[model samples]
Target: MTDLNQTALQKGADRALEKIEIDTLVVGAGQAGVAMSEHLTKLGVPHLVLERNRIAEAWRTGRWDSLVANGPAWHDRFPGLEFEGLDPDAFASKEQVAAYFEAYAKQFNAPIRTGVEVKKVVRNAEGPGFTIETSEGVIQANRVVAATGPFQRPVIPPIAPKDDSITQIHSAQYFNPQQLPEGAVLVVGAGSSGVQIADELQRAGKNVYLSVGAHDRPPRAYRNRDFCWWLGVLGLWDAEAAQPGKEHVTIAVSGARGGHTVDFRGLAHQGVTLVGLTKAFNDGVVTFQADLAENIARGDENYLSLLDAADAYIARNGLDLPEEPEARATYPNPDCVTNPILELDLAKAGITSIIWATGYSVDYSWLKVNAFDERGKPKHQRGVSGEPGVYFLGLPWLSRRGSTFIWGVWHDAKHIADHIATQRKYLAYRDASQRSAKD
Candidate 1:
C-alpha cells in the first residue's frame, strides 16, 4: 500500500475502534459506491464509504491491460461529470476509467475510506442499527448500502477436469496473449470477453479455439451511429417493465478505434476455430456440445430482432434517419458458421491454455440479514431491501436495464439517498415524541 492508503487505513482503524455512528455506510468504493456517497453528501446524510482496496480497484486490476470500455465515453459519464478532455466518441481505456472514478470522488469529496475490508454485517441486537466488522475495527450505522457491483467473484465451473499439463486461468486474470505458454488456447464461453480474448490470441499468432454459447451479438455501429445511441433513442434503457429472470448479458464490443464489433463471423474469418459449449474434460480429452450452427442461428435471430425493433421505433416515431449503406452487407454469412468440434484431444491439439470466461456471482455471506434469496442474490426492489435500513445498488435491471452502468447509478443512488433521509427524519421524530410523552 502507498502512504496515502496507509493513512486512510489508519484513520479507518481509529474510526472503527471508536465505533463511530454514521447515518449510512456504503460498501465498495467503485463507481457505484462513489455515486451513492455523492448523492448522500448532497442530501446532507452523514455517511461513510468502505472499500476493500483502492477506489475503482476492479477497473484498476480486474481487467486486462488492453481492456477498454465497451460503451463510448459520452454515454458512460456519471451525473455531474462528463468526459471533458477526451473524445466523446472514443472508448475509454481501463486506466482512464479508473482515473475518472478517482477524479469523481475528489470532485465531490466523497467520504471513502480505502483498505477497509468489511468482514461481516449483522444487525445490532441492542439498538436500532447494524454492526459492521471490518479489518480496521467495527462501525455502527443506522443503514447500509451494498454498492458492490454485479461482478463479484468469478464463476468457474466445478466440472473442469484437473490437468497438471494444461494451464488454466479465468478471463479476469488474463492480461494478454503473451502471458500464456506457447501452444493452442481454448477459450470457454462465447460472451464478450471470451470472443475478445480469443480474437486477441489469434491475432497474436496463437492457434485459438472458441467455445460457443448463447449470446447476443449487437452491431457495434448501426445506421452510421453507435448502437447505444439507438437504444437510448428507443428508450430501451428506461423500459418501465424489467426483464426480471433473464441472465445478465455482456456487451459485445471493444473500445478499439471506432469501436470493434465482437461477432462470431468476424472471429471465424480471422481463423479462430469455433466449437460448441464445453461439456466435460476427462483424461486429456475435452467434450463439447454439437450445437455451433444452432447457436449461430440463434445469435443471428437476435441480431435481426434488434434491427427490426429499431426500424419499428423509427417508423412509429415518424423520424427520418438515413440507413447505413453497409448494414445489409454486414450480416453474418451462414456458410462462415463452422461445424462443432464434438471432442478434441488436448495433447494432440497442442492446447496448453484454457481460459474460462464464465461470468460472475455475488457473495453475500457476510450479510447476516434475511435480505437475500436462496441463491444469495439480494432480495431488493430498486435498491430497497426487504429488511429495512439495508439496500443494494449497481445491480442489473435494478430499476432499468442500465442500472449497472455508470450513467444509470445516479438514478438508483438518488432514490436510495432520499429513502435514507426519510428514514432518518422518521427516527428522529419518533424519538422526540417518545421523550415528550415521558416529560
Candidate 2:
C-alpha cells in the first residue's frame, strides 16, 4: 500500500488528468463500490475507487441515529464478513453498519479518495476508453464503473407540492419525532418507512394519520411457505439476465417498488390511525378518496396468492426436499396493520405534518451522459452500459432480487469484473494485430 499523503495524492491526481492510464475507475465507495474494489484487487486488476465523501458517508451521515434497518442483520451482512457478536436477528444501527464498511475497505486496502466528486464522464471517440472530470482533476481510465446505489435522490410527490403553512420533509431528512409540527400528522406512502414513521410518531403521543395506497403485505409467520425459501429453492435470484424472458421472470417480479411493508397489525394493536391515498392537501386541509384502501387490499391479496402458487409449483416439482436445499428459516407474512387506518374521509378528520415517504426517484441529470432508457434511468445489459467501457451496479432490478442486497453485489461484481477483464484482453489482442499489420 502506498502512503497517500495530501501532496502525493494531489500530484498523482494531476498527472492522471493528463491522459494517464488506468485499468479501471470506480465511482462511489458505498457497498457496491467497496465490494467491486475488493473483487477487482483480488483479480489483480489495477483500479481506484472514488467517493464524494468519506467512506460510507451516507450511512454515517444521512440516516437518523436511532434508526435501525428493517431487514435483519443476517440478510444485510456484506460479502466476506458476517454480522455476529450482537443479536443475530437484531437490526443494525447506522453507525454499526458504517463501521463494518470502513473495516472492509481497510481489510482489502481499497484505494478510495474521499471528498473527490466525479462531475462528468466522457467516452473516447477512438474507442480506447473514457475520461472522468472530477473536482480533484481529470482521470483517464479504460473502464468506469458507476457503483452509485438506487437512493441517489429523494422522490417528493407532486400532490404535496410545497407550501408555507404545512411543513414538508422526506423520510431522509427526518431525524427525531420533534421535527414534525405539534398537531395531527399525516404520513404518506405505506411502505416500510411510512409505516415506521407513523408508528414512531404515534408512540411519541402525536396524533398521527398514515395514508397508504397499493402495497404488498407479508405476514409475520408462514402458513405453509416462505417466499425467501421459495426464492432460494427456485433459484429465483441466481445468476441470470435481468430481462423479462424465459430465464429471468423471477428477477422482473421482485423489482424495487419502495420500502418494505411493516408489521401493520402491530401498529394497529398500538392504536395508530391509518388513511387512504392522499389526493390533495390545500388550504390547511388534506383531501383523500375512499377507494384507496380497497384497491390496496386487493393488490395485496393477489400478490400473496401469486407467491402461494409459486410455492405449490416448487413443491410439486420436488424442489423443497431436505437434501435438495440448504436449511433456512421460513418467510413470515406481514402483520396486517391496515385495520388501524382511519378511513380517508379527510373532510371529517383534521391532519398536520406531511412526511413524504411516497418513494425515491432515480436522478442522473448531473452525469451528463447518454446511457438511460425512456424512464430516465441508466440502461445496462448485465451492468454493461450501451456505451463502451461504462458500467453500473446497485440498480433496482440490475440482476435479481438480490442485486441490491449486500450479498447479491458479490455475484454481480464478479460477473462485471470478468466482463471488464475480457474487454481488456480484446484490446490487447487488437493492438497486437494492428502493430503486426503496420510492420
**How does each model score on lDDT?**
0.81, 0.66
Q: Write the per-residue lDDT of candidate 2 for residues 1-439, one digit (tens) a residue.
A: 1223323433464244434457788899998999888888777677878898988887887765466654456656775776646565556777877888888887867777778888888877665667778887777777888888888888887777456656778888887788777777778777656776777788889877777676655432232333444455657657455433332111101111122334443355566665667777565466666655474555456456645656576568866533312112223323333343323333345555678876666656545567887877788987888977788988766777678777787678888998887876787799799999999
lDDT of 2 at 91: 63
> Which candidate number would show the highest TM-score if scored against the true structure?
1
Error of 2 at 337 (Å): 11
Candidate 1 C-alpha RMSD relative to the actual structure = 3.9
Best by lDDT: 1
Cα RMSDs, all models: 3.9, 6.4
Deviation from native of the Cα of residue 181 in model 1, angstroms: 0.3
Expressed as tens digits, the lDDT of each residue in 212-262 for candidate 1 is 877777777776667788779878888855544345545556656458666
The CA-based lDDT of model 1 is what?
0.81
Provide the lDDT at 117 for model 1.
88
Off by over 4 Å in 1: 1-17, 240-245, 249-251, 318-320, 330-338
